[model samples]
Target chain A: MPKRYVSIWFRYLATDLHSLCQPQLKSIPFVLRSPSHGRMLITSSNAIAESKGVCQGMVLADARAIIPELQVLDDRPDLKEKLLTKLAEWCICFSPIVAIDLPDGLLLDASGCTHLWGGDQNYVNDIGKKLHARGYDAKVVIADTIGVAWGTARFNRKYQVVSTNDHLSILQTLPPEALRLENETVERLHKLGLHKIQQIIKAPRASLRRRFGQDIITKLNRAIGTEIETIVPIMPVEPYQERLPCIEPIATRVGIEIVLEELLKTLCGRLTNEQLGLRTSILKCYRIDGKIEQVDIVTSRPSHNIKHLFQLFELKLQNIDPGLGIELFLLEAPRVEDHLPSQEKMWEGSVGLEDVRLAELLDRLGNKIGTQSIHRYLPDEHYWPERSVKLANSLQEKPIISWRVDEPRPVQLLHTPEPIEVTAPIPDYPPMLFIYKGKEHRIVHADGPERIEQEWWLQQGQHRDYYRVEDEEGNRYWLFRLGHYHDKSYKWFLHGFFA
Target chain B: MVVSKADIFKGLQTDLLRLQGLKSVNNCELNNFLGPIASAFPNHSFPLGVIHELISHRQEEVAATSGFVTVLLSMIMGASGTSIWISASRNVFPIALKAFGVDPDRFIFIDLKKEKDVVWAMDEALKCGAVSAVVGEIGEIDFKTSRRLQLGVEHSGVTGFIVRKASRNIGTIASVSRWKISSLPSEKSDRLPGIGFPKWKVELSKIRNGKPGTWDVKWFDGKFFPTHVPIDTLVASDQWHKKKTG
Candidate 1:
C-alpha cells in the first residue's frame, strides 16, 4: 500500500517560542536576533511583524528602520531545535512515526492512523485545532507522498488532503519553490516565466534538466505520486520483545528453569541472526494470582550468548516470587547494538571488549550494582582541570586525547570546590597557611599558581589560579584562588585531594 | 600424601576454628598469590575462593589500601579472566593504577553513590566465575552480606576484596582474611628529584588457615619486597587499634 504522509508546518516557529514563553509578545510586532552576539539579520518575525512587511532574512538594521518600536530578541536555534524535538515526541500520540522537517515542519506517517480518532479530514482538523489551542499556528496536509504533503502544508491556503491518485493534479497549482528547490533555482525558473508547477510539468523534461540540472525534475516527480521518496521513521515500529505463555503455572525452580532455557534459545537465536546483541534485558514473570515481578540485568558490553544470559537470569531466579505460580514469562531487550563482524581468535578465551568472559563478569557486576554506577573517563583537550576529562562511552573506545601528566592532577576531586581561608604576605604568592573546614594547615611544599581561565562562551564562571600545596603533615591539597587579585571577589577554595 | 593423625590434627585446628567462624572461612583451594607477600601465608599463598577484608582508618591509608589491593589484584588476575572494582565514593584514580603495575584497562570500575549498591555490585561481581576478582570500597559489611559474598566466591572460585573505610565495626565477618595497609613513606633515592617506590605496612589481622602478622613491603621495579622491618615489631599498629584504645 502507498504510504500516507502528513506534514504539519509551524509557520511562525522561531518567533512562536518567544510568544509562548513571554505571552505578551503574541500580539506585538517582534523579530529575532542573536541574544549575546553582535546585532545581525532577522531570523524570524511574528505574525504582526509580518503583516507590517517585516519578514525572515530581513536585516536587523532594516527591520528597525521599518518599525522603530519593533522588539528584537535572541533567536536561540538550540532552544528551537529542543522545542521541535519535544513537539515531535508529543506528536507520537497521533502517529508512532514522527520526524522533524528541519527548521519548522514535522512529517508523520499516518497510513493506518486516520481511522483511529476519525477519518483523514477530521484527523487533520483535530490536530490543527489542538495545536492552535496551544498557542501555535499549525497548517496540516496529508498526501501519499512526503513532497506533496510538505509543499501543500506551507503554500496552500487551507488544509489539503490530496488523494495519492490525484496528488499530481493538485500539486501542479502550487509554486515552483513548493518543489523544495533552492531560492536561486526558484528565481531562475521564475526568470524563464515558468512560475507554477503545472508550467514545469508541461515543460519539456530535457530542457528543464539542461537549465536547472536534474534537481527540479526529481523534486517535481517526488512532489506528485509518480516517484517514491523514503522517510526515516524516528522510532522503530516495534521494540525487541518475546513472551512465553504456559497453561499450567510453574512454581518449582526446575520448571521455571525450563521456561527460561526455552526463552533464551529463541531470543539468542534471533539476536545472532540479526547480528545484534543486547546490553540490557528485562524479564517479567506474570503469576496466575495477578501478581507481576520483574528482574533486569545490564551488561557492560552488548551480548547474546545463551549460556551467559541464562546464568545472569539464574542469579535473579531466586528473587522472583512464584505467588500462586507464574503462568507467563516475558523477555525484553531495552538496549541493543549491532554485533559487528570481526576476526575471531582461534583460542576460546580472548582479552578486552570482545571477551565473552569479561562481558559476563561485567554483566553480573552491572546487574547487582546498576549499570549507571560503572564509569570510565578519558582525557579531553581542555586546560581547565575540571574540563580536561570526560566520561568514556565504552571500554573498547580508546582515548584520542592522552592525559596531561606534565601537570599533576588530584586523585580525588571534590564534586564542588569548598572555600578555604588563605593568608599570605605577598598577594601574588601561594598561601603560607590555609584553614579548611576549621583546621589550619601550614604549607611546606608549594607549586606556582597556574592560571586557568574559565571558557566563558560555554558558561560564565570565575577564573582560577591553582596551586599544588603539600602540608607539613604530608597531606596534599589542591587550592585555587578565584579571579584576579585586584578584584575584591578573589577567594581561595580547596578543590581536590592528591594521592 | 602420608595420612598422619598428628599432622592432620594440627592442620584441622585452624580449619576447625575457621569453620566455627572464629577464623575467617574454609580454604577451598591451595593456589597462592604471587611475590613475597604470598610467603607470609601458611601455604605460601593467599587462600582462593574467599573474601579478604582490608580496613583503612585514615584518608591517606585509603591510598595505601589501593596500592596493596592493586598489587594483589595483578597476581590474582594472572593470565586470564577480568576483575571489577566497585566503590561507593569514587576516589580511586585509574591513571594511578599504572604506577602499581596494574593495567587500568584490565579492570572494570563501578562507582556507586549508595553504600548498599556497592555491596550489591560486589556480590554480583563475586558470583560471576568469569571474573577473576572484585574490590569494593565500602564503609561497612554486615555479617550476612559478607556470608553471601563468601558463598558467591566459593561456588565460582573467584576472590574478593572488601576495603572497609573508617567508622566501620571491627566485628566478625565471613571473610577468609583481614588486612590493614598504611602508607610507610615511599622510599626516596638519594640523587632523585622525585619520590621513589611506594612503601606500605600490610597487617594481616585475621586469616582462616594462616597465621596473622604485619609486614612492611615495597613495590619497587614492578614487584613486592618485604622491608627490613620485622612483622612483630609493628604489632601496636593494626585496624583494631583505634577501636580497642578509644
Candidate 2:
C-alpha cells in the first residue's frame, strides 16, 4: 500500500498569533524582532508588512526605514516550536499521528486516516478551513510522500493532492529548491543553469554527488517515493484506548451508560486475552459545543472484570454534564499492570482480602468517598504512641513485626493530648485528683511514674512520666507529666482512655 | 402420664421465642465466649449476621464499647477473614485490637468527614460477602437506615455493629439488639499496686424476644470472664475506702 502524508504550512504563524491575541494588530503592519549578534533582526512579519517590503532577516532599523509606523513586538526564542507543537496536538482529531515539522509546519501520517473524512481532497480542505477559522493562515497539501507534500505546500501556488503515479511528473515541474536542499546547493544549481528538478533528476548520480554531495540526492529520492519516512507522533498512542464517534449527538444518561459498557467490554476483553489489568482509566466525552468533560476511576488492585469496572465508572457518571450532547467518546487506560488469572478454589466461601469481590467493593467505596479516607495500619517499631502504627501502602502488605502487646495501651487515643489540672504529691507520684473540662475526678487507684524518655534521634523534647489512673466512676485515664517532677513548671496532660 | 403446668409454660415460651425469628442455640462456638450472657439472648446463643447497636454517652464509655465490639469482631472473623471499621472521625488505636486477640492488619479503617458517607460505606461493607464483619461509629441512625443495613447483611451474612457516640436522641431502631457498655472497677487481688485488667459493665438494654440484663465482665487471657457481684458489696467497699481515707 502507498503511504500518504499531509503537510500544513503556517504562512504567517507568529504574526497571526500576535493578531489573534490583540485584534487591533490584525489591520496594521507589524514585525516580530529578536536580538541576534547584538542587533535587532526581524524574525517574522505580517502580510501587510511583507507587502510593504519589510521581510524577515532584515535589520529592524532597515525595516523601520521602509515602513516607519511598523508595530514592533518582541519575539520569544521558542515561539515557533511551541506554536507548531500546540497546533499538532489540536490536529489529532484528523489523524492520530501528527508531528511538528520544525520552524512553521506540521506533518501528519494520513495514510489510513483520509477515508474517515470521505477522501484526501476533503481531508486537506477540512484542515485548511478549520485552521483559517482559528485565525491561522495554513496551506494544507496531501500527497503520496512526505517530501512531495511538504514541498508543494510551501512552494507551489495551488495546494492540491498529487496522485501516486504522478510523483516524478510533479517533481519535474517544481524548482530545484522544492527538493528541500541546502541554500548553497540550490544557489549552485541556479548558477549552473539547472533551474528545474527535471534537470537535477536527469543528471548523472555520481557527478551530482561529487559536485553537490549526497544530501540533494537523498532528499530527491524521498520525494519520489523510492525511500520510506516515519513520523514520531506528538501524542504517543495508548495501547489500551478505544474511540467511539457518534453519528448523532447523545444527550441521555442511558446513552452514556451504553457507550461506557461497550467501551469497557472491548477494553476488558483485550486485557483478559493478554492476562493484564488496568489500575486507572479515564473517560473523555467530546461535547458538541467544543468542550470536553472527563471522569477518571482508580482501582485498589489491577482489574479486568467488565461488570466491576463498569460499576466503578457508573458511580462517577453523574459528574459528567453532557452539555449540548456529546459527539465522541474516548476511554483510555493510562496505567496497567500484569494480572494473573485467579485459580478456582474448591471451597465456595472465600473470605479474605485476596478475594476479587472484596477488591471490587473497596474500589467502589474508595471512589465514592475520596481514596484517602480508606486506610490499613501496620505496626511500626516506635515507643511513642502516635508513632506506633503506620499506614499500609497496599492491601497485600503484611506486617513485619507483631504489635507491642506487653504494655497496656489505651483502646482510644487522642490525636493531641488535652491539658488537665492535677494535684499530686510531687517527685514521681501519680496525681491524686485531676480536673478535665471543668469536671473533677478523684483517683482511687493509681499506677505510675513509668518514665519514657524522648527519642532524641527523632526530636528534642521533655521526657514524659506516664500513669494509669482509675477515677471514682471506674473510668480509667492515661495521664502524662511533662518535665521533671522537681521542675517548677511541670504540666499534666490527659492522653488517652483505657477500655 | 400428664405434663405439669410448669413444663407446659416452658414449652409455650420456647414457641413464642421461635416465632419471633430467634433461632435456638445450635452453634457451640459462641456459647463459651458469651458464657452467662448467652442465656439472656432468646436462643441462648449470640446472633450472627445481624446488626447490633452499642450506645455510649461519655468518652470513656465509648472506649469500653469499642473494646467490647472489637472482641466480638475477633471472634466472628476468626483468624483469616478481614473486617472494616468506618467512622467520621476515628480515635480507636489500631494496636489495641491486638490486645483483644485480633491481628491489627486484618481490619481496614475508613475515616470520613460526613455521617452520610459513614453510613454509605457501612452499607457497602455489609453487602460484601468477603468481609466477616463491619463496625461503624456514627452519632445517629434512623429506623429506615438501620433497616437498610439489616437488609444488606441478610444476604451477605456479614455481621455489623453500630457504635453510637454522643447520641442525643434514643429512637427505636430495627437492630436485633441494643447494648450499653461502661467501664467497671477491676478487682484488686491482695492489694495490688497497679490497675488490673479492663473490666466493663455489659448491659443488654434491649433485645428482641430476649431478657434484658446487666453483668460485670473482665477481659483477661484474651477472653471474657464474668465477674458477677452484688451492687451492695460494691457500695459497702466504697464506704470502707471513704472511712479509711477520712
Candidate 3:
C-alpha cells in the first residue's frame, strides 16, 4: 500500500488569529509587524491588506505610505509556533501522526485515515472547510509524498489530491522551487534558465549535484517516492492502542461506557495473546468541538482482565465532560509488563498476595481514592521507629530481614512526640508523674531507660531514654527524655501508647 | 427422658442461632484461641463472616483495642492468608504487629484522608474473598453503612472489624457484637522491677444473642492468656455448667 500525506498551510495565520479574538479587526486591513535589523518589518498581513498594496517583508513605514489607514499590530516571537502546534494537535482527529512543519505549515501522515472520510479528496475538503469556519485561511493538499504536498499546499491556488502515479507529471509543470530547495539554490537554477521543474528534472545528475550540492538530489528523490521519509509525531502512537470512531456524536454516559467496554475488550484480548498486562492506561475522548477529554487509571500489578480494567476506568469516567459530544475514543496502554497465567487449582485455599482478585480489588480502591494511600510495609534494619519500616515497592516484594521483636515497641507510635511535664527522681530514673494534653497521670509501674542512640551516619540527634510506664488508671504510655538528666535543657516527651 | 428433653432444647437453640447466620462453635477451629470469651458469643463460638464494632474514646484505649484486634487477625489469617487495614490516620506501628505473631508484610495498610473513603475501602476489601479479614479505623459509622458491610461479609466469609476512635455517641449499628478494651496494669508475677506483658480489660458490651461480660486477658509469647475469670463470667459459666449437668 502506498502512503499518503497531507500538508496544511496557514496563509495569514497571525492576522487571522488576531481577527478571531477581536472580531472588529475582520473588516479593516491590518499587518502584523516585528522589529528586524533595527527596523519594524511587516511579518504577516490579512487578506484585505494583501489585496491592497501592503505585503510581508515590507518596511512598516513603507506599508503605511501605501495604505495610510492600515492597522499595525505587534507580532509575538513564538505566536506562530504555538498556533501551529495547537492546530497540529487538533488535526489528530483526522490522522494519528501530525507534525509541525515549522513557521506556517502542518504535516500529517494520512496513509490509512482518508478512507474514513470516503476518499482523499473529501478528506482534504473536510479539513479545509473546518479550518475556514474557524477563521483560518488554510490551504490543504494531499499527495503521495510530504514534499509534494507541502509545496503544493503553499503554491497551488486550490486544494488538490495528487494521484500516486502522476508524481513527475505534477512536478514538471510546477516551478523549480516546488522541490523545496534553498532560496539561493532556487535562484541559481533560475539564473541558469531552468525556471520549470521539467527542465531541472531532465538535467544531468552529476552536473546538478556539482552545481547545487547533494541536497537537491535528496529532496528530489524524496518528493518522487524513490526514497523514504519519516515524520516525528506530536503524540507518539502507543504500541498497545485501540481506536473507536463513532459514526454519530455520543454524549450520554451509557454511550461512553459502551465505547470503553469495546476498547477494553479489544486491548485486553491482544494483551492476553501476548501474555502481557497493562499497568497504566489512558483513555482520550475527542469531542466534536475539537477538544480532547481524557481519563487514566493505574493498576497495582499488571492485569489483562477486561472486567477489572473496565471497573477501574468506570470509577474515573465521571471526570470526562462530553461538551457538544465526542466523536472518537482512543485507549492507549503506556506501561505494560509480562504476566504469566496462574494455573487453576483443584481446591480453594490461601493464595496470599499472589491472588488476582486481591489485586483487582486494590486497583479499584486505588483508582477511586489514590494509589499513594495504599501501602504495604517491609522491615528496614534501623532502630529508629520511623525508619524501622519501609514501604514495599510492589505486592511481590518480600521482607529481606525479619522484624525486630526482641525489644519492646509501642502498639501506636505517634508521628511526632508530644511534650509532657514530668516530675522524676533525676539521674535517669523514670518519671513518677506526667501531665499531657492538660491531663495528669500518676505513674505507678515504670520500666527502663532503654537508651537508643541516633545513627550519626544518617543524622545527628540526642539519644533518647525511653521508659514504658503504667499510670494509676492502667493506661500505659511510652515516654522518652531527650539528652541526659543532668543536661541544662533536658526535657521529656510522650512518644507513644502501649497496648 | 429428662436428658432427651434438655438435648432437644439445646438442639433447637443451635438451629435458631444458625438461622440468624451464626455458625455453631463445633465447626470452628478458633474456639480454643479465645478461651472462655468464645462462650459469650452465640453458639459458643467466635463469630466469623460478620462485622465487629470496637469502641475507643482515648488514645490509650485505641492502642489496646488495636492490640486485641491484631491478635484476632493473626489467628484468622493464619500463616499465609492476607488482610487489609484501612485508616484515616494510621498510628499503629507495623513492626509491633510482629509481636502479635502477624507478618507485617501480609497486611496491606491503606491510609486515607477521609472517613468516608476508609469505610468504602473496608467494604471493598471485605467483598474480596481472597483476604481473611479487613480492619478499618474511623471516627463513626451509622447503621446503614454497617449493614452494608455485614451484607458484604455474609457472602465473602471475610470478618470485618471497625475501630471507632474518639466517638462521643455510640449509635445503633448492625454489627454482630460490640467490644470495648482498655489497658490493664501488667502484673509482675516474678517480682521483677520492670513492666510485664501487655494486659487488657476486655469488655464485651453487646452481643446479638449471647451473654456480654468483662474479663482480664494478657498477651505474651504470641498468644492470649486469660489472667483470671471475673466474678460475672464465673457465675455465668457456673449456670452454664448447671444447665448441662443438672
Q: Pick the candidate with the highest TM-score.
A: 2
Clash pairs of candidate 1? none
Select the stronger candidate by DockQ from 2 and 3.
Answer: 2
Q: Candidate 2: which stretches are off by over 4 Å? A: A1-238, B1-26, B228-246
TM-score of chain B in each prediction: 0.78, 0.84, 0.88
Looking at model 1 chain A, report the run of 10 residues with the lowest lDDT sum. Answer: A347-356
CA lDDT, every prediction? 0.77, 0.89, 0.89
How do the residues A1-499 of candidate 3 rate in per-residue lDDT, one tens digit apiece?
A: 8899998888989999999999999999999999999999999999999999789999999999989999999999999988988898889999989999888889999999999999998999999999999889989999999988987887667548988777668767778788888899999999989888889878898998998999999988888789898998897434899999999999999999999999999999999999999999999999999999999999878899998999999989999999999999999999999988888888767559988888899899988988899999999998877799999998889999988888879989999999999999868889999999999999988889899889999999898889999998889999999987786688899989888
DockQ for every prediction shown: 0.21, 0.60, 0.57
Q: After superposition, how far is residue B99 of candidate 1 from its true place, in Å?
A: 3.5
Each prediction's RMSD over C-alphas, in Å, is 11.4, 9.9, 12.0
**lDDT (Cα, tens digit) per residue for candidate 2, span A160-220:** 8887777778878888888888899999999999998889889998999999998987988
The CAPRI-style docking tier of model 3 reads medium
Instruction: Kindly list the per-residue Cα lDDT of model 1 for residues A268-291, writing each as its tens digit.
Output: 888898999998899999999898
Error of 2 at B130 (Å): 1.2
Residue B22 of model 3, lDDT score = 73
Runs in model 3 deviating more than 4 A are A1-238, B25-29, B229-246
* Model 2: per-residue Cα lDDT at residue A86: 84
Q: What's the best-to-worst order under TM-score?
A: 2, 3, 1
Q: Which is the winner by lDDT between candidate 1 and candidate 3?
A: 3
Q: For model 2, what is the error of residue B206's alpha carbon versus the real structure, in angstroms, after optimal superposition?
A: 1.2
